[model samples]
Target: MSPTLVFGVIAAYFILLLVISYFTSRKADNNTFFTADKQSPWFLVAFGMVGATLSGVTFISVPGEVGNTNWTYLQFVMGNMVGYAVIALVLIPLFYRLKLVSIYEYLRDRFGQNSYLSGASFFLISQTIGASFRLFLAALVLQLAFFDAFGIPFYVTVLTNIALIWLYTFRGGIKTIVWTDTLQTTFLLLAVVVSIIMIINHLDLSVPQVFTVVTESDLSTIFEWDWRSGQNFFKTFLAGIFITIAMNGLDQNIMQKNLTISNTGDAQKNILWFSITFFIATVLFLSLGVLLYEYATTQGIALPGRSDELYPMLALNHFGAVAGIVFLLGIIAAAFSSADSALTALTTSFCVDILGLKRKEHKNQNRTRMLVHIGFTILMFFVIIIFSSLNDSSVVSAVFKVAGFTYGPLLGLFAFGLLSKRTVNDKFVPFVVILSPVISIILDYNSEAWLNGYKFGFEILIVNAAITCLGLFLLKGNGKNERLNEAENL
Candidate 1:
């Protein structure tokens, strides 16, 4: 895989995305950019979301994870399925009935100005870090595959990647992302399927034999019965539920695509479809991990220091140019599918939630939105560079660890709003939201020593949310019905 050839493939991919953006953005207005004017096809949204949901982290980290965690991630996937059902049945209808551009507006309607700002602020912090983490993986891969070969610095590679995403996405936003993500998802899946076949053929194993090998291998372990281990089935499964509820159901980035559909019924259909497809996709990636580890053992290949490096090492160095090209395209597709939407969602949240772009009759609203869009792109660039310098673990773990703390506050806020009728003293929310994650970090750091060797995994999200919920409850106002009536009137 020549650096020039990899660069050429990436250029071709970007051209395709730009072509889609051109068509989608023509005659586009704020409405189209925000909600696709509520006309997106359910199936297209479903397909595109598969790519966005997986991102580059899953492309590389999920398979690599099998070396250590085996199939315990499947427990999380099952929880995700349950969470999606909850989103389709519970959250989507609420958003549609409310006619929300930014879902945080729900916090405003149910609570007050301070609550709304707190929710939006949490999303800004969470998404900035989350999106940057995903892009960090993508940028690192690009640096290894191309930039390093050219003696280019890593920050330059990060900027180049962000610039390309901004180039295609600055105009149309979610309208452009809906179609482009569908195409990217296709390539992302193709890369996985092709890589599997290549690995199987190289190992001289039949399809059934590949399955048999994986089943017989130690990496096939999926259930962890230990009560204290972080990967224990119940802990991981429950964490997955809250994580999906918070990260997908509550987060603006995933829900923005769902909200693009014309009606509640279609949105439900999109979520259900995406849920099933995402489960199957997880199985495929996990299966590929089994094969990769099996191939390494049988061929006596020295595995990399980091498990995350295994997929790329094999694909680029050993699996021939075709596999290398597929790997490059797959990662780029996976990375852009998620990154483009995050950029759009960050801009959308800032303009609609923070800046109140919709309320004001500004003549230059579109221009203002573009500047916000560019501002988030630059923010992601710096965040990725920061993450690259500081990260020390598998990216999949890092992403979920951060999510548990950041998204936990979101989960608590939404739960408190939906399940309880009481409103909190809105002004206290920012303090509570900030404090929850700080407490979670302290507990996470001392979990093993304090809990007598009980380690916290993704389930720490549940703890973080519980702490936030407790704080909000203590701040609860006495006039429950009054706030409920006010929300209804709003």
Candidate 2:
């Protein structure tokens, strides 16, 4: 496909998003931007979240992962089902009951000011890095597909990508995202389905024959019974459960949309339906992976050195121009759907959590919100640039690894607040939170050497949270009214 054609497709897509933003942001205020005035349709939020959850990383990397790890990633997908149930049953009810604009506000009501800041701070760091990493992958693809052909520098591509997201998202925020993401999700799923059909037609195989070929391939193996392997079924499954709890249930980017729903029942329905759709969507991506590998081997095509490049390389170079066009639109849809929401959630978190915008009655509140939104846009631009320079592993693995360290403190803080009754010394909460991830990093670095070559996978998040919980227990206050006194001190 020509660079000009690909650029035209992306430009058209953004114009559509801007059109949606213009309508959604009309008569909007702080409440509308931050929480969509709690009027979002449950069905829209559920459908839109499919694109948000998959993001650009999954769009590109999951299919590529098949060549190396087979279908073992499905273990984590199964675990996600359990995790979504927890979110629907446990977390959604708590947020609705508390009437929270920011989910971390629950930390404030349960713990003191210091603990509240700690939880919010961890989310800020986690989402900033997480969102940046995802955009970085998307920017790299854009660069490869369009910019490099025009002799454009990589940094220019990064800035342009962030700028487009800011343009659509700055006014309507989550309100715009709810509608825009639904549209993007449609294109994303269409791209996948179209690519699958094209591959099947190219191979001249029927639907049953495709499944039969996939089942016969080694890449179709789903379970990992080897206890010592990092991809062991139990480890990945449990990791998926905790990861969904920490990253989605506890995450501001995701729960921000859930909080936009007016009531607990609707929010729960959104989560349940999102989980079912997510499972089916993931199976489709994995099946595409199987087909890609089968096509490559049958056609005697040489695969790329990085497993991450497999899908893009084949789609652009081998599958002809129509497939190339679909791939371009699909990735742009996936990237923007995720990035726009992260930008809104980050702005929402900083304005409400750090600046106390909800408490203040300033005339310039809208101005301040826009400024904070721009600040995060710049912050993510730099973070993406840094990751582009430094990232060497699978983009998916890098994302989850960072989640294990950064989100661990959040998991522990929330667990301590909800599961236990005791309040920790407020001043010491920061120290414990900081120490948990540091210890997790050390253990992760030396797990093989120090524990007789026992490899730790995504389940390391569970270990990281446990350490933080233990630290909080040791710092617990003695008196029954310790939490009361701590609140009064603030």
| Highest lDDT scorer | 1
Q: Give every collision pair in model 2.
A: none
Model 1 C-alpha lDDT per residue in residues 382-464, reported as the tens digit of each score: 89988888988899999999999999999999998888876688888989999999999999999889999999999999999
Q: Taking the tens digit of each residue's C-alpha lDDT, what string does model 2 give over 352-404?
A: 99998972335599899999999999999999988888987888888998999
TM-score of each: 0.97, 0.97
Candidate 2: regions farther than 4 A off: 359-362, 481-490
Each candidate's number of clashing pairs is 0, 0
Reference-based lDDT, each prediction: 0.91, 0.89
True-structure RMSD for candidate 2: 2.5
Any idea what lDDT model 2 has? 0.89
